[model samples]
Target: MAAFRYFSKKLLSSTLKTDIRAPVSNNYVVCVRLLSYTPMPYDGNPDPGPIFIKKEVQTLLTTLTRVDLAKVYRKRKLGGRQLEQPVYKFMTDEQLQEALDEAKRKVDEILQIPPVVAVRKPRDKVVSRDPALQGLDSSNYIFTDISYGVPDSERIILVRDTEGTLRDADWATRDRINQMYFPVARRQVTPPKMFEDDKLDDLLKRGEYNFILDRACLQFEPNDEFYQKVCSVTYQHINENNKFEDIRSTRHFGSFAFFIAWHKMIDNLLLDLIESEHIDEANALVELYAQLHGEKFRGNSIEEYIGKFSTKKAALELALQAYKNAAKQKHALEEGIKRAHGLN
Candidate 1:
């Protein structure tokens, strides 16, 4: 059946071409053997024969013994076949060169154009101070909404010192900074540290907290459940206490400290969920913060990330089974080969 299919393919290829003589059906055996070295569509593999078709007959003759090819050709020709003269005989060297050169030029032309970049420039600014920027604050924080376009968004920190120089506690712009601090503090689920203006400034510089917070606001969480939860938790944590030391002494620290602690808690909580295959829920809980604020996060689509997880699991199992089989067969193969060669 395979031999019949093979001969049929060669017959079809010959018939499809014009200006080329077609092979006779009687030469099926020779044609089938020659076509074995060529890939077939039955294997769903691309035919690579066209790539080597331009090779010089002398070069081909070196790799393949002439007797082998001639035997196949002669047998087919003698089998009462209407012989198709080799196509190479009809094409002069110059004609072949022109064909090859044209193919090369087309390939070169295709490769010359630049590919389009997928990421377009964001049409919005990072921070804006305009009254129109109110609802959009849900998507982005507005520090100064000046109309002049900046190349990239920036986190704005307004600092005004009463003493002018960098003196400890002497700065009167503490109120302005505190205003920003309060909003962030309200967002933290637990007040981990004392709520003091100076501590807030120090925390911002020490932890690089604003960068993390900025992303959290813009993160795309479905139905906004996670965002609402985070906001409410933070608001309660900060407003519930009055004494700064008492709040600082509590199990949860200020916003910066609470953010870190909350992440660890969530990671621990989700481990069992992910392990037990309640991973979709685990993903939902982790996804928003993971995209925006999580430390170990890298950007990945939900499907892509899950696909990688399944693939890795399958691959590991296959590798382990292969390793065991290989180990068991290792010395047995050597012994068998030695005995087969009569050297044992």
Candidate 2:
């Protein structure tokens, strides 16, 4: 029985050995060989003939060879989807010089006119002073009367200094004295007349137009809410006027007040121009004003146009011109003010 068992064990061991040592499939063997193999380095023959190649092309080729395959693929895909093409054409040396020369000529033509001074027209009406009130002495007036009882008589009398004594009185005291002694009727405080669309034609005809220029003063900076409101109103008026063929000029134009007001407006406009870096245009406007006003515009014309130099006085004069032009053009002032305020 033992012998039979021993014989069975020996048979099982022999069978296991045979299974372990059996050959693998042809496909499996091929895959295993590939996985284990190390590729041999290229050992091709050197070039027999000299190769002509540009340095740039060779460098590019070498650079491309070192770049990762993934990166190369990405760059190729992006290149195909390029959004921008160069707009400027290549110019020859002669063509470039010619273009530059033409630009210079145009600039010269623009600045050819010398700046003229703006001369203000003389006033038609002269103010008259009353002879009776001109030489009247205020030295005899009592201290109480002048001060309106703010300072005690004893204290005032002690001080005895009367310089600007009447000027120091409060508004209430002055108003009361004027009411009692002068006996002048008080003027009623009424709101300014609001401009209406219906009344515009009549106002224009009567030369009583109150458009943007009336409100667009230098009292407020360009960024101020009031200035913006003035600009908005002016633009609206200009746009409305465009509908009519024979538009009348603004009522204030050519008037002394208009001249003064427009000059002030120009000061503001020039500031706007400078802030915008439109130095050439600003300088031209200055020259134009100088011509109109007969004022001396300081600074060399060539230097000013090229933005090489500028002066406060010249800038101010230019601004005045800008203002005059704006009033003449109506909407130009509003546009300039808006540009200065960065609203445009």
Candidate 3:
């Protein structure tokens, strides 16, 4: 068929029966399957070119990083509440006093200190009170009002300007401290509904229905792309005339049937020729793809990634394993079909 030989090699090597246990913390089991309705795109379309659409989808799914999640969380306005330190603790005693003095000086220099009273008898012609000096008590001088209270306690100091008005700076430092510790925003716990609806809404709402509606159309299609090539070889020898046909109609069936017989034979030969390369990234790809599929097909929630595969390869293996396991459980999809169709 087209060049799906690569996929068969990769698929078979990876799909051999394996029992991957479900993680203890998780409640979901993941599986993989081809998302296709037909094989038309691959029939005669050899050389699918370098730009395959499914690869683009895989890239988008798996390449999402923490930074991208951060952006999305920011847009959704869902984030952890950042704790704030006390503002009073951030300032030193010198800064507090400097601010207080600057504020007092701007009003009036005399206001910086309390004013003295000029005492005299206005009608006394002899002026018995010494004009050179008033009986001023220097010890009780109001100018030195710093020791009025405890060393760092709050005390009221009033000053009268030439205009005969008073000004007071009362507990301004405490007010500044209060403003600095103003409450931060509260965090919101995003309901599971947002992820469930948003993720599948676009694919279901926007994708063209034609890619999914016609199966027979895919049969005669060229084996030009990666997926199409796999499907072509996978379903070879089966009648392509009808839209609804099971893969068992062909000789290659069961979990290990194709892998053990046909694909393995060709894979070794290809490795001798091409020296193929594979990496751990393949597992990540499978998981991402399965996640998207579970969300799309099973109506699973993002917060509860329970119904999807954790990786692309794992999902595929799960599917193959499921098929084999179903047989071991004395159940097969064909038997289910027979019962449904009244042939059981």
- Per-model RMSD to reference: 32.4, 40.3, 34.8
- The clash numbers for all candidates, in the given order, read 13, 14, 19
Q: Each model's TM-score? A: 0.16, 0.18, 0.14
Q: Write the per-residue lDDT of candidate 3 for residues 106-151, one digit (tens) a residue.
A: 4332111111111111221221223343333323111113454333
lDDT of 1 by residue, 1-344 (tens): 23344346546666655434445444555554543222111110222122223233122212211122222222321333476785554678998899767765554332221111112222222222344434432332223223344321222333222222222221122223333443333234333342333444354334423222233343312113333233323323222221112222111222322232223223322333344444444444344333323334356433333333322334333443454466569878988999999996
Cα lDDT listed for each candidate = 0.34, 0.35, 0.29
CA lDDT for candidate 3: 0.29
After the best TM-score superposition of candidate 2, give how far the Cα of residue 263 lies from its true spot, in angstroms.
Answer: 3.4
Which should have the higher TM-score, number 1 or number 3? 1
Off by over 4 Å in 3: 1-230, 235-279, 291-344
